[model samples]
Target: MTASRSDALFENLLESAQRLSFDSRSPQLYELESGDDERHGMTPEWSPLYGTPLWNSLTEQERARLTRNEVAQFLGVGIWLEVGLQVALLRAGHSADPSRPDIKFLFNECADENMHSLMFVGAIEAIGAKFYQRDRALDFFGWIFRHFVWDEVAYGVVLAGEEIFDVMQRDWMTDEDVAAPIRRAAYIHVVEESRHMAFARRKIRDRLVGLSRIRRAVSTLIIAIGTHLIAKGMINRRVYEDLGLDWEVVRANIDGNEHHRMMFRRAAEPFIEFLSKEGLLNFGARWIYRKSNLL
Candidate 1:
């Protein structure tokens, strides 16, 4: 991964950013149909409880509400990570040489994330869904992630989070059944994040070159653990209560549903393969990934 390649990527990203930037406050966002009692506020297949007995038993209105809430919660996780990333990014790039192309692009990336968080918050609020909070321990870790991490580790975590979110959002952007406002948001995120992920992956590769096997192995486990937390944190328990379903029961069913598991496996396949080829998917880290059902 040459600095020249990074410079080209950054140049392209900068041009893309200039040509396309948006706010969450657009009238189109406000015009989103009330999907509360409708059939498709979100693509039904993405509901956390999808393919479970609970999902099959849900009424049309209930299903709509659940999927809408599920999508909101997914975006909620992005909001959580993005907030922390804003800090991490600033600190990481704070000392970069101004002459480097990626330096300017780093600040541009930060601005993009700021807008994305606002967009997610606006969409969730518009849909009347809750942006659930992480537990105390996770919150503390999240704060640490937001405030301190950078370098190869931050980009490692960044790629894990972005890849999963990108895969899902890419599907939404093309699926007609997904809500229009949500699709628009997804499209914006996917486009911008493609550049971010490319940049992060390159950074990881560059930094990994001289790291010892022990350090790489340790970092791999940490990255896998971080991803596991993010994956498990996506669906808030309260999203089920709107349908009068028990969270524990619904979660149990979702855990057992081959359909949902397969979805995750498929989405994570390329990412896992990439990490494995790069030697970041070691034995210990593989176990953590399996625990999260992303294996």
Candidate 2:
């Protein structure tokens, strides 16, 4: 478009960024310590094994242990995702006009995400938890995503990660019973990510105009698979072992866990609705989401 239009878009984005920017340095951001109860890590209903026989078999203490480990694993995954997003966003910004609003907001996003990583790491360390690595088998997708931001597909990929977690964090922040530390972290993420999600949605929708149906179909499948894998990877099988739970039994429960399925579905609602509105959630993509139980 015109130089004036890009400058206008950038100005609006930068204004929002300056208005909502957060500081990770506040002493209040890190005041909670996990004592006997680790409920702060996660709510019981969020556990993968919640509502299963295995979950019923555990004492409250044991449940807290599991929650702690499970939450830590997710934060580890957050670190991984935020790291990738920061890299990809920075790289994608290279083609932007350095003086434009998009580039400035892109850099702002990177800064926000870096602070998020530090906050997540602080939470993990405070819980005395270990980080879980992503399943390397899917590294190729990461490579493709990192290298390919030319299409609107790239922002859609970014939104998938943000929206899924955004929903969950929204829930956490609202629940009065959630621990302050977790609540605070979720609160921070929810606030800042609201802006990021808005930016991503705007970018995707604006860029999707005039795209061919064939390309949209292909990107839809790629995004579906990416979302499925990202959701699956967050469970972190090794976390069960770390918590002294049998992976086999835990896996069995998670496979058919109605609560887990519901959680996935609920968390995905806004994302699915947005994509549906955009006409990206086509028949083939719907089938994939059904297979993943995220529809």
**Using Cα atoms with residue i matched to residue i, what is each candidate's TM-score against the true structure?**
0.92, 0.92
lDDT tens string, model 1, 162-237? 8988888888877777666677788888888887887778778878988988888778887887888888877667
Q: Model 1 scores what on Cα lDDT?
A: 0.77
In model 1, which runs have C-alpha deviations exceeding 4 angstroms?
33-39
Candidate 2's residue-wise lDDT over 1-295, tens digit each? 6446655765776787788766776767767645524454676677778889998998877787787788787777776778777777778677777766777778888888899988887766665566766677446667777777454666777788899888888877766555566667888898888878888887777777788889888888888888877777778778898877788888999997999999989888999999999989988899989988798
List lDDT for all candidates, in order: 0.77, 0.78
Pairs of residues at least 3 apart in sequence or in different chains that clash in candidate 1: none
Q: RMSD (Cα, Å) of candidate 1?
A: 2.0
